[model samples]
Structures are given as structure tokens and as C-alpha cells.
Target: MTTAIYWFRNDLRLKDNPSLMQACMAADQLLPVYVHLPNLEQETPWGFQRMGQHRKIFLDQSLQELRSELRDFGSDLVEVPGDVLDVFEKLRAQIDADVIYCEQIQAPEELEQVALLRNAGFKINPVWQSSMLDSQSLPFQMQEMPDVFTQFRQQIEKNKFRFAYPVDHLKSIPPLPAIDISSTQSLGRNTISTGGKFQGGEQSAHTHIQQYFERRLPDTYKQTRNQLIGMDYSSKFSPWLAQGCCSARTIAKQLSEYEICCGENEGTYWLWFELLWRDYFRFLHFKYGKKLYSPKGLSKHLGNEFDSEHFFKWSSGNTGESLIDAGMRELKKTGYLSNRMRQIVASYWIYDMKGDWQAGAAWFESQLIDYDVYSNQGNWLYIAGKGTDPRGGRPFNVAKQTLDHDPDEVYRKMWLT
Candidate 1:
């Protein structure tokens, strides 16, 4: 019998998963696996844990839900904890699998992992199914894609970008070949409270989407999305989207349905606009490659310095700038912040504090439950004037932002106090 290994990376949900489906078609027996690397829990160059407690808890919960769902299909997820290559080598010793099927991740480290496996004589079949629009369908090639987000969005809108319907969830998956998982341990839970606002799982993700549409949240999203507090301010889809419990295409499909039922409005259209931004960042990784992670970034801007003292104060919510401090405290406490707050704090770090943008980006990577490599790097580069933005770095005036978004100090009071 043909046996294949289906490796789960960022794409965790079974619904709308092209890679998982391909694995099923190629093999009569499958081994579904998720490798937990030790580096995730280790300290970064900045002396902070690579994965903070908040994100760790969410990931652990998501994995648990994924494993349970697989059990319903008479299959199981073999979670191996170690270096990916090491675990794969161990698995190969036990089972003569022909190939590994998984989602394509554009980031450098993830791409390197695939290369390492291929060099070891394992056929890797990676499906590009994460974006809302397929890469092949874009009007321009990755090399020729626009650097500015607006230009990209206009081209897509002018040409009328279209996405394929999401694939249906499998009713039953092929049973796994016998393999021992007794040595592997599950991801550890966080002692930090999640504020009971977010839970990680495909089921929970779908429920949130359903409620957002049913309660008419889309109609007011454009107005409230920038607010500093409140659950209904935005769709709250990023955490799940980052973890792959929710697919971008599925979200686009649902938004289209919502428009059809409720009639289209600016609020609804903005959501689609935001999804386009997500796709732009994902595609940017293809064009820029390793440059996205570089200190000088794509623009090759120079003269950047890191101040550990300033970084510590900024990260710990002791910066003394009330607005910046409040946002930092909220993120430290909740593992979340509004989109507007993200930009403001990022600006303060790069422009005001005159600190290295890379440090700020790394800190976000360590803290955010919703952190995606593309978005995190892309935004930081934009703020530091190192990425695609022609105007060069965005500098937000803290006082002006305070007056504009939180004039009444309601948001400041909530977090600061």
C-alpha cells in the first residue's frame, strides 16, 4: 500500500486544505504529523523567549483541537517534539513513506526546512493554498509584482481578481500506519490568562465568523475597527488566521455571502480590502525572500542602532509616554491590541525612541498570538522606511494620535489604570 506523510505547518484546519486532500489522494495510508521545535521555547538574540506565554497557550489549544478532530476520522496527528529534520529522520526509520505533503510557507527558515528535507531524499509536495487569491492567477508574476500595496490592490480590482471556492472538509481520512508516539509530549499550556476573549481551534474560528455575520458586525466594522478597546471593534480573525485554523479564502467566501445577504457597504468592503493586504504581504515574501528579515530591509537604509535600555522600557510598558505605555500594557496583558495601536507603538519605537525596528519586530513575534511572519516583518519595514512604501517610514505624532483616536482618554484610562 502507498503510504505518505501529511505534515501540518501553519495550515492546521482540514477544511479547505488542498495539501491534506492531495496527501489522501496519493496514499492509501497516511501519517499526519506536527513537529514542535525546541527553538520555539528558547531565547532569541534579544534575550526574550521566542514564543511568549500568550501565543504558546493559543497554539497548544489549537493543536489539541486538531488532534481531536483527526480522531473523529479514525486517524491521529503524530506530534513529534524536536528539530523537524531529526524527527522526520526518526519517522523514516519506522515507515518507508514516499513523500511529505504540506503547505508552502514563503519565509526563509520554513523554506530552508523544505530544502533540508529534499536534500535528505524525501519528496516534498508543497501546495500554495494560504492566500485569498492563488499566486498563479495574479496579473503580474512575483518578480514583477508591485512594491506598493495600493498599486497591487488597484491592479487586482481593475482586473477583477477572483478566488476558487474552498474545498469541503473530508468526511473520513485514511487510517494512519502504526507508529509509536509515546516518546513525544504535547505542547505545554500557559499560566497566563487569555482574558476569556479568544480560544484557538477550527471549530471556535468558524463560530466567531458565523456570529460576526449573524450579528451584523460587518456593517459597522469600518467605523469601529480602529478603536482601542471592546471585542466588537474588529472581526477578531487574526489569531485564527495566523494559526491556520481559519483560511483566507473561507473568510473571503463568507464575506461575499454576507454582502449578498445584507447588501454591500463600506464596512463590508473594508474587510475584503484588509484581506487583500494580507495577500500582498504573503506575496511580498516571494519577491523579497531573505531581505524581509534583514536589518537594512529591502531599501538598504543604513545607520540603525539598538538601545537595550530603551527597548526594555518600551516593551515593559514603562516608557512614560502615556499612549505608548498604555498600548504596551494592553499587549503585555492581553496578547492583543487594535490595528491602530500597533502602528502607533511601532512608530514610537522606530522614530521616537530611535531604537532598532528589528528589536520591536522580534518582540512582537515573541508576544503576539496572531503574529504572522510576513505581516510582522512587512509592517515594521514600512514604519522604518525600509520596505515597499515610497514615502519611506511612517512617523506618527503620539499627541495627535491620542487626540484623534482616544481624545476622551477612555482607552488610556482603561489600560493605564
Candidate 2:
């Protein structure tokens, strides 16, 4: 009996999962696995956990739901704790697997893991299925892509490229003999220092998506998307999308359908536009690998690091700018922040503090539950006038941002002490 292991990295959903589907098709017996790597706790150059609590809670919830869904598919998600390599090696010894299948990742440590597995003689198959528009359908090769986002977006639109609809099913697998692996053994609810917050999961993601589209999308998205107030302001899909509980294409598909049924407008279209930006960053990562994470970034390198005291003030949300402080405090407390607040705080870090942008990005990595490698790194560079941003440097005028987004001081009161 041929056995193949489907390792769940970021992609948690069963629907439209090309990597999972491929595993089902190629093997008679399937082992779906999720590895919780302890390396996530290792401190970066900045003294922070690589994976913060917000992201941790989201993944935990997503994995629970994914386990239930896979049970329906005549399979189960076996979770493993410890280092990824050790867990995989242990699983391989027990399952006698022929191959390992996972979603492709461009990030540094993730790619390194793939290399280690391949060196161990396990055939690794990674499928690219996360983007709104598939990489294969792009107008030009990633290397030959345009320098700026406007040029890239215009070219793609002018060419009239539409992404394929999402598939709701995974390929059927004949029930594989159950392995000795159990989720409890693989996933432990360890006490993580996250300033006392609960983790979010697939159930929350689904609920948020349903409510946002059904109740909130119609009235106030365009006007309120920039609002720093509450949850209903925007879709809040980033946490799910970050962990692959949902895909950009799935969200975009829903948006298009909603637009058609209710008549299209700037608000609905703007959501898709942001999704496109998400897609653009993913592709940009594909185009440029480790360079995206470099101190200099894609545009140019900055031989800079953060001032110890300045970084502490920024991370702790005590820079004295009420709006910026509020946003940072919200992130430290809740592991979530509105998009406008992210940009506002990021601008404060880069332009205002004159601190190293890399340090700021690292802090966001430690704090944001919805932190996707591409978006997090890409955006930091953009704010620092380093990435694909056209005019470059989205410097926030502190007074102007305060006046525009939080004139009522509602957001300020919530976070600023």
C-alpha cells in the first residue's frame, strides 16, 4: 500500500487545495499532518517570538476545524509538536510514507525545511494555489514583471485576466489504515506569553466572513474601511487568509458574486483591489526571494538597525502619538489591528522615528495574528520607501492621520493610556 503524507503548513482548508488534492490522487493511503514547530518561539534579532499569539490562536482554531473537515473526507489531520524535521522523521518511520506533499512557500525558513526533507530522500511536492490569480496565468514571467504596481495592475486588467473559480472538493481517498498518530500528541496547548489573549480559529473566520458580507458590506465599507474603531469596519479576512483558512480567490469570488447580485460599486471593488495587492505581493516574493526580507529591501538596502530605546517605545505603544500609540497597544493586546492603523503605525515607525524599518517589521511579525510573510515584509518596505510602491514612502502626517481617522478620539481612548 502506497502512503503519502500531506503536510499542512499554511493552507488549512480542504477546498481548492491543489497540494492536498495532489496527495490524494497520487497515493492510496494519505496521512494529513500539521507540525507545530518550536522554532517559532526562538527569538529573532529583535527579542520576540517568531510566531506571535494572534497567529498562534488563529492557526490552532483553523487546525481544529480542518481536522473535523478531513474526518468527513475519510481522513484526519495528525498534528505533531517539536521541530518540523524531527516530527516528520518520526512520522515517516511509523507510516512508511512514499512522499510528502505541502503548499509551496517562498519564505526563508520554510524553504529551508523543504530542502532538509528533500535531502532526506523524501519526494516533496509543493503546489502553488494561494493567489487570487494563479501564477501560471500571469501576463509575463515573474522575472520580466513591471517595476511598479500600477504598471503591473494596468497590464493585467488591460489583458482581461480572470482567475478560475475555486473548487469546493478534494479528491476522494479510499480510507487509509489509521496511523498511531493522534492530534493531542501532536498539538499541545502550551502557555505562550501573549499579554493574555485568546486564540482565533476557523470557526471565528467563517463567522466573521459570513457576518461581514451579509450584514456589514452593504452599508459602510468604502467610507468606514479607513475607520480605526471596531471590527465591522472591514472584512477582517486577513487572519484567516494569513493562515490559509481562506484564500484570496475565495474572498474575491464572493465579492464578485455579491457585486453582481447587488450592483457593483467602489466598496466591493476596493476589497478586490486590496486582494489584488495581496496577490501582487505574493508574486513579488516569487520574483524576488530573500531580498524581500533584506535590510536594504528590493528598492535599495539600508544599513540600519533600531535604537534600543526607540524600538521599545514603538513596540510598547508609548511613542506619545496618541493614534500611533493606540494602534500599537491594540496590536500588543489583541494581536489584531485595522489596516489604516497598520499603515499609520508603520509610517510612524519608519518616517517619524527614523528607526530601522526591519526592526519595525520584526515587531509586527511578533504581534500580528494575520501576519503573512509577503504582506508584512512587503508593506514595511513600502512604508520605508523601499518596495513596489510607486511614489514610494507612505509617510503619515501624524496630525493629519489623527484628524482623518480618529477625530472622535474613540480609538485613542481604547489604547492610549
Question: Per-residue alpha-carbon lDDT of model 1 for 310-414, expressed as tens digits?
Answer: 999999989999999999998988888889999999999988999888989989998898999889988888888999999988999999999999999998898
* Angstrom error at residue 377, model 1: 0.8
Clash pairs (backbone) in predicted model 1 = 385-393
Give the TM-score of each candidate. 0.98, 0.93
lDDT of 2 by residue, 238-338 (tens): 87888888777777777777777787787886777788888888888878888877777767557356788888898898898888888888888888888
Computed on alpha carbons, the lDDT of every model, listed in order, comes to 0.89, 0.79
Off by over 4 Å in 1: none
**Model 1's TM-score against the true structure:** 0.98
Best by lDDT: 1
Q: State the weakest 10-residue window (summed lDDT) of model 1.
A: 181-190
What's the lDDT of the predicted structure labeled candidate 1?
Answer: 0.89
